[model samples]
Target: MIARIAMLFVAAAPLALAACATPAGEYPSLAQREIERVGMVMTPPQTTPAPPPNPTEPVLSQARELVESVRTAHAAFLASESAVRSRVAAARGATAGSDAWALAEVALAGLSTQRSRAMVALADLDRLFIAASTSGESTETIGEARSEAADMVAAEDAVLSELSAQLAS
Candidate 1:
């Protein structure tokens, strides 16, 4: 009889513990339950409106001017492109320091000067980009202008290199 009673108690022990344990889905939430009782509505933060756009900003105008200068220089370069190429072609078989070679060298120098003019404008645009970036201003205009000037200068460099190679040969 004592063995039977021990068996019954052992079988009932888990049932008693299960009664004390709460269900997983029945736990209490940590969220506020009575915010309305405080009688105040929650409001989002207010933000300031943006300023109106200005078309005459000095930095933008300066960028425009610099880009225009690059274009002008590029135009000048194009104007002399044919003459320089002719001189280089003429000097193709000439000995070093001969008259033809000298003329070719002068033509190359003139072309390089034009390229330098565009590069100088590009350098100014670079400075403007740095200044705008450091001062928390937008650098889009300056960057665009710099790209244009750099492209023009690169094209000029290619032409100069080709002509110089011809003259050297």
Candidate 2:
């Protein structure tokens, strides 16, 4: 009985030691290994810094220029409409289908064509303003651009109303 007990104790001792031993290639202490790994990971990377963002002034300037162009086109339309009105007024006392009346009619047709072209220009400017608003522009800059666009549109509406009144008269 004593020999069998001694044999069992010898067998269990080797199994217990094997269970407690660290695996091959593994660190002896888990906490120390984790601390060392975290220290390594905490070091900053060795890459160059990024460049600064581009300036927005140029974008704003371009938007302003586009607004000016729309204003100019609107002014031209107003001038052309005024010219048509003047021609019509001059032909008022003349006979229908007379040379002066015919001339006035031709001038009015030309004004229509000019007005169509100006409208196309204004539409393009509107597109530019929308693009400026959506292109990652600063909010303040976009607000200024929007305000300018609104003022221009109001001016355009006033001019159109005046033109309508002239035609009605």
Candidate 3:
């Protein structure tokens, strides 16, 4: 039993040594391969080139369109207000309990509601302009639009106030 164990150890020793040894070839040693792999991992990766800047023409055009839309809405509101005023004026001499006076009252109420809606719409447009300006859009166009919108909104407020006073009287 002792002789058999010695023979087995002698046979396995050469196999174990061979496993630890690198075979003779063109391939690099284990240490060299590890160093190369580590170098590759430690090195920074190459970056891609950046894209060109965007054109401003489209942004400016869109802002102009929005401004035009606000102008159109403002004009429509003014026309409606004028028509309502004419109706109210025509009914001015009617008795309080008469059908004409009641119709005029209804028209006044509707005008007040419409005025509120127009104010809200103008506010929403203001918010949109502010957002566009803050988000790096073309500031020149946006500034002009904002200025115009502010003026329109102020005029609308004045007209609405005057209408309210008229309705009271």
Candidate 4:
């Protein structure tokens, strides 16, 4: 019984020493440390500026030139308007396709040709007005010039209509 007890004690001593020899894992610290406070900076937003106004002198000069051209054409048309009116008056009672009617038609054609000169200038004005409008430029002066030329053309059209009516009757 004594020898058996001695052998059990030796076996227990080795198992206890093996348990103590095994290593343990590392642990985290719970102590508090100093902290730093950071500040946020901001910048202003950027914006685009409006465009500058364009110069008016060049446009005004071009408008004046175009208006002058219309006036010249109008003057030429007016010079022939009286002659055409007389021809139409003489053919007022003539039969269709007669010599008088043919002469009146020729006179009317001449007047129309003269009026076409003014129309050409008016067309140019229209082009300028459109270009200015599309390109974001000012169109007031161009519009005024176009209006004046249009009025002259309208007057010519009225005269033509009157003469045509007289000839038709």
Show where candidate 1 strays beyond 4 Å.
1-56
lDDT of 1 by residue, 1-169 (tens): 9999999999999999999998778988877777655656677899898996763388889999999999999999999999999998889899999999999999999989999999999999998899899988888878888898899999999999889888878
Off by over 4 Å in 3: 1-58, 91-102, 109-121, 132-138
Q: Candidate 1: lDDT over CA atoms?
A: 0.90
Q: How close is candidate 1 to the true structure, as a TM-score?
A: 0.66
Off by over 4 Å in 2: 1-55, 91-102, 109-121, 139-169
| Cα TM-score per model | 0.66, 0.44, 0.54, 0.65
Cα distance off (Å), candidate 3, residue 4: 54
Q: State in Å the error of residue 159, model 4.
A: 0.5
* Candidate 2 C-alpha lDDT tens digits along 1-169: 9999999999899999988987777756454565477556676689988996675776667666766665676567667776777877777767768887777778766756555554554565556556656876565654565566566566655655554444434
- Maximum-TM-score candidate: 1
Superior candidate under lDDT, 2 versus 3: 3
Query: In candidate 4, how many Å is residue 145 off?
Result: 0.6
lDDT of 3 by residue, 1-169 (tens): 9999999999999999988898678675566565477556675689998995674666566666766666776777777787778767867767676777777777777766655654665565566667766876656666777678768777877877776566556
Question: How high is the CA lDDT of each candidate model?
Answer: 0.90, 0.65, 0.70, 0.89
